[model samples]
Target: MMLWITIKVALRSLWANRMRSILAMLGIIIGVGAVIFVLSLVAAAKADMMGRITAMGTNLLVVSPGQRGTGGVMSGTQQNLTADDAEALLAKIPQIRDLAPVVRGNVQAKRLAKNSRTSLMGTTVTYFPIRSFEVEKGRLFNDADCDAMSRVAVIGATTATNLFGTEEPCNQVIKLNSINFRVIGVLKSKGDQGWFNPDDQVLVPYTVAMKQIVGVDHLNEIDIRANNEADLDTIMDRATKLLRKRHHLQEDQDNDFSIRNQAEMLKTADSMNQVLALLAGGIASISLLVGGIGIMNIMLVTVTERTREIGVRKAIGAKNGDILRQFLIEAVVMSGSGGAIGVLSGFVLAAILSRVTSLQASVSLFSVALGLGFSMGVGVFFGFYPASRAARLDPIEALRYE
Candidate 1:
């Protein structure tokens, strides 16, 4: 009953100066909203990254040529990886289930009246299963085509649409860099992984790409698939040893190639995202602190304005604890209401961002709870001093004032 009375008094006091209470709450509204918005966006981005990583395939490893140096002066990448190196790893490493030597180039593709400039990936038939790609239409080129250096190409879904429009691209002849090639297959859509759109490139046999398209015998990268997740590290070590032996590196020499595991890369990406999220959240939280200070300033002014009312209540035999509770409850109500409004605004903002941009925003219950809890905590921390000061006033002195 006493709690209800205190709350009623608090509400009545706030209602008396409606404009002042609203102004005080504005800071909290913006602060909480900003925090929720930034955190939600970060969470969405992290989720998207993880999804793309999972789609790449399990127990996967990638090999790329390392940088070359001449007398302590660093040069560009060493073009040393070749199709022969890929064959060597497959033959020597028992842990490797499959491997694909990849070479790539940028070329202009034309068919009929349409033309599109895109990347050309030269890989073998084993590339599809190793990278979790599927042939949606027609058939993928076989090992025979790769061995024979056939000028057959498989187009990505976006590439198909770009070069052929609504026309069926399968079995159609598309000219790549003025070299006529038959499109034997169209790949299913894989969407975009950050800036790299898997659906925007064309795939061809590595032999053909090296001989006619890219005109280089060296491979750009190698994709390796382990028999199981547990064998990934073993495969990496075996591949490194085999490559070292094949490349004729001395005992004291550094590796001329780099091996990267998909799981480790995903973990590193997640860690970086976490750091970004914390930094963004931390910067936004400064506004919450500012909001807390605003609450303290307003509560101080409120205490001064209601000094005569405090004296009247004390004259009626109200205890210091009762005076403190009333003022503290008023502060809490202001901030709590502001937090509710902020939470709603945050959700709306998140929805707007999802609709307007490529960014995916998802609001979790944890964020909402944290925002509200922080706002109330701010009210309690900043409201105490003013409440205590009001309670400490001398009843005689307060009543004597006009």
Candidate 2:
């Protein structure tokens, strides 16, 4: 009966001050909306990053000249990787299914009246499988081509279009650094990656790149793909040892090479997503706190205006718990309503975000539940003191108030 009376009183009070009640709830709405929007956006970005990483290949590993660290691709000063390292890895790491040592450079290409600039990459034919590349129209370089140091090239989709226009590029001759080469193949389309376009590349045999283009014996990186994902650790260990021995490194010396797997990439992406979500949640919590203060302030004003009603009820045998419950419930109702509105608003905001940005936006149900729960908790925490003070008022003094 007491609980029922509290509910009734709370509903009636809010109904009597509809505009003020709405005003109090708006703070919570904004807070919850912000939390949901920020979290969903961050989650989308993490998902995209993970997808791109995985799309490269399931059993793939990246080997660079130096150890991975905080600074990124330029983190390590060592540049010790070479074609020999790739050959040794292939010969020794039995679990390795395929490997490619890559040498990269920037160059200009022209065919007849067409001219365009693109990146030149040198690698073995196995790079197609190790990097999960599919040929769109023409064939990739074979082992014979790599051995002969052939003056032949394969073009990416974007590179083909940019240089040849509507012309069928296969069997055509293109000039690279004023040297003539036959375009024997074109890579199939791969969409724009956030950082670079694979379709904007021109591929030649690693030997050609070393002898004709960059004129360097060293490689930019080595790409490896294991026979199975379970073999990743074993293959990585074998490759690292082989490289260290070739370089004649002391046992106490740190490794001058780095090997990266899919797991590390996924973990790093998850950490970034978590940190972004936490920061957004912190900012949203502040808004909820401010909303709670609004509830408390309004409730105090309510207590002052209803002092005579409280005195009459207390004199008629109403208990302090009843009055306290009434005020508390009112605060909760306001905040709860605000939370619902905020969640709906957040979904709308997420949709808008997706349309505007490249990031994928997904509305998670947990965010809704979390937001609503937070809002109600805020109401209870801030409303308690004000509710208790109203309940503790002296009946004689309340009755005598003018």
Please write out the lDDT profile of model 2 over residues 262-348, one tens digit for every residue: 898788778878988889978898888888888888878888888988888889987899778877887787777788889989999
Q: List the global CA lDDT of all models.
A: 0.88, 0.86
Task: Pull out the clashing pairs in model 2.
Answer: 136-188
Worst 10 residues of 2 by lDDT: 68-77
TM-score of 1: 0.82
How displaced is residue 376 in candidate 1, in Å? Answer: 2.3
- Model 1 lDDT per residue over 105-170, tens place: 998999877899999999999999988899999999999999898999999999999998888889
Prediction RMSDs, each to the true structure: 3.7, 4.5
TM-score of each: 0.82, 0.78
lDDT of 1 at 118: 98
Q: Looking at model 1, which ten-residue stretch has the lowest summed lDDT?
A: 280-289
